[model samples]
Target: MPSLDPEEGDAIRQALGLDRAARPYRNHYPAPGDDPVAGRLVERGLMERGAATPAGLVLFQVTEAGARQVGARLPEAEAGR
Candidate 1:
């Protein structure tokens, strides 16, 4: 988690929608070039670039491991395994 401290786990979690997805969820990053966290998440295999959305933008869905990290579970359809 270089450049991202342990205290910032919340930020990463929020970015992954683990915190707000209690009501709903979607796959994405905040913006382009916001790669630091994205890179880290990718490195950990906690997130991945999935198919393009209707607008052709890449979707970043959280992996099973990522959902576990936030004490949530990815639906069977969304689970990587």
Candidate 2:
């Protein structure tokens, strides 16, 4: 797994979980105070920022490397499900 900062990664994880199941992107937590995991991922080119729309949303997607990183890090419980 990539060395993501837990706090930041957790935020991203939370954001990912909020999607409606059909959107290409999801919104982040309402605030962008600071998240080390998110910062490191973005800094390392694993995550990219997208525009914040008038609807109050920000978008993000996993890079190819990021997809691999997350895939590799899946917990056994989640993988089985």
Index of the highest-lDDT prediction: 1
For candidate 1, lDDT tens digit of each residue in 38-68? 6567677777755555655555667666666
Residue 30 miss distance in model 1 (angstroms): 6.2
RMSD of each: 4.3, 8.0
List candidate 1 stretches off by more than 4 Å.
1-34, 53-57
lDDT of each: 0.56, 0.48
* TM-score, every prediction: 0.56, 0.47
Count clashing pairs, candidate 1: 0
What shift in Å separates residue 44 of candidate 2 from its native position after superposition? 0.8
The number of residue pairs in model 2 that clash at the backbone is 0
lDDT of 2 by residue, 1-81 (tens): 556666655555554442344322433344342445555667887666655656565555445455344442322332222
